[model samples]
Target: MNLKTAWIWGLVSAVLAAGALAAPAASAETLRICSDPDNLPYSKAEGAEHGLYVDLANLVAQKLGAQPRYVWWLSMNQRKALRNTILAGKCDAYFALPADKDYGTRGMKRTQAFLDVAYAVVAPPSFSFSRLADLKGKRIGVGFASTPQIVLAAQGGYTTVTYRTDAEILAALDKGEIDVAFMWGPAAGYDNLTRYHGRWRVTPVAGEHMDHQVAVAVPAKDAALLARIDAALTELRPQITALADKYGFPQGQPVAVGMAQVQAGPADVALVPTAAGGTPYGQPSPYRMMAVAAADPAAAGRELFNSTCSHCHSPNGASPIRARDLRRLKGKYGDDWLKEAKQTIEEGRPDAGMPTWGGTLKEDQINDILAFFKTIQNN
Candidate 1:
């Protein structure tokens, strides 16, 4: 989501200069963090429940033996808020940034990713299935420009309901207008805990386009601060994870987006469904589904998965690698199993010898592969 437009960018320098020119003397023992004043799960104007970023900032400062101070402002327009506060040096650090250079290339550099978050499928606890096929004609809630909307449109199986924002998506999901909702995980989970009182299950989606890595951002010119922040995040990973969980964020392994995944039938080549808000930014994602392997990609994917991935991740839950068992997915991650599994297949943990098949297999093949895996999940 481009939170700001060209006009907002035009005012950046004036606002930033004002903040810098008005800054007081710095203190070595103070860790200044900039954040939105009213963004729940990230921050709030009332510091009483100082959202995730503030909580994280406090922990980071404590780790550095520094006092934490927040430079709160209206980040309804992130471009203006970030420019005026963080980039202007009114704040030393900014939290909850995408850990990608392209995200905030203007005078800002992101620390190594501290966590990853994604859109999640929110449903009742008794909801049995995970993927689109499992939904089997159920209504799904999605926002404009969201991956779930895109993938569900591609599937054309389940009826796709639309919402303009996360708030609306959650409302539809909570009101039972939609059977399930696909939403940003932090927003969904945080709302689940804070507003809904853990009313629904929030499971993170996987796949390349699904999750975004999050980091603490700092001024690009300040290498020392960047390194220090990165060091602190690494040093305090456990606490950070715990804190993220406390705020209802998805952590560690996440489920893949099975929004388009379904059991094979006569309509092998899926039809693209129209979304309520039209296309995301009016442009189709370069991603396209390839032809399946003729004999039901899921079955093919099953054979392939069992023979290939099964070597590492057993499908029948009989493998020596308990950490890698396919059948025990629900036990480990609830409804996120399919989405998580699809992600693992496409972008394998080469760090652990699982190869990235994204290059080798078409996404449709991978979808069927995940569908096959889904058939075997014990959860």
Candidate 2:
């Protein structure tokens, strides 16, 4: 070969090599997302149906010009799951956190809410539920230690049958054991579509703490990434809505149930007085304080547990992690489970990451937590 031709070929080879080397660097830009492996209608690890969060994550990653990499983590204890995964640098973002700024988001920044999630009333087509009063005299099914159960118990006059999960509640409703089931909207809707073939009517209900906005969360330092995610979410809003429909999420206007004023301490549940017309959606309702009366200890205890213990043990003691599942305490320890639990709470199980609450929490608070646990035991 001629010297000139040889030089030209070497230059061509060098350019190609450089391009090849640089190509992977650009392609290697991945959006690492942490999500629950088993949570359906939200996220899943494997299958044709990857759930709403997984699909949304993929769309966001595509918009960011990055590959999607998932860090599978069971989010039974949301705070702990966030601590172990996203805050621990295992992933770049966590899907579907409450968009409310006051939620337990100390070290993370959340994108604008892309979805509205709320508790829903699932019943047969003939049944109608426009307001809370409609629930009176009806056998309502609710998840044990759930918001619905707490609210119902506080309200009184409503006969609510408690179940461990939303699926159980649906099953009960199907068997004619309960007149209606009030549960999480997304789960109920997904189950209605998949398990029940969309036979039941899943209608979302509006009230305090009944509905919440959901968003993606990232580490606080990832301001640039957060902004990118916000833009992607905005651009993909239409797609997200379509995905929600595909997953059978309850859509359209929610039924407005008049607000209930729930107090954390010992007090009777009072109905929050409405204005001349009615309370607007997403706006705080007017309040008229009534005389305090005795409150349900179990209900009050649930509030405390969710705020404090849910970080590790999970909300309502329904931990998917076997070791931490408070529901199984009775089955595991037999008659002495309560005693064992009390001692454990008083003394820190440092080896297992359980902190001592003896000094941090009051005796009444401990009793309240224990009271809540007793109602949830899987005996």
> Largest lDDT belongs to which candidate?
2
Off by over 4 Å in 2: 1-28, 261-379
Model 2, position 305, has a per-residue lDDT of 72
Worst 10 residues of 1 by lDDT: 275-284
Candidate whose TM-score is highest:
2
Superposition error at 240 for model 2 (Å):
0.8
RMSD of 2: 12.5
Quote the lDDT for 45 in model 1: 51
1-379 in candidate 2: lDDT tens per residue? 3323332343444455467554323333656788889888888888779898988888887777666667888876666787899999998999868787777678899999999988899988888878787888888887654567667766666777766557778997999878999888888999999999999999998877678788899999999999999999999989999999989899968997644335542355454444321111121222332332136667667765764566467778899999889999999999999899988988979899886777666667678778888999987
What is candidate 1's lDDT per residue for 9-119, written digit by digit as tens? 223433544585542332326566787777778777574576767777777776665656667777655667777888888988987666655665688888889877776
- Candidate 1 at 192: error in angstroms? 1.3
The CA lDDT of each predicted structure is: 0.66, 0.75
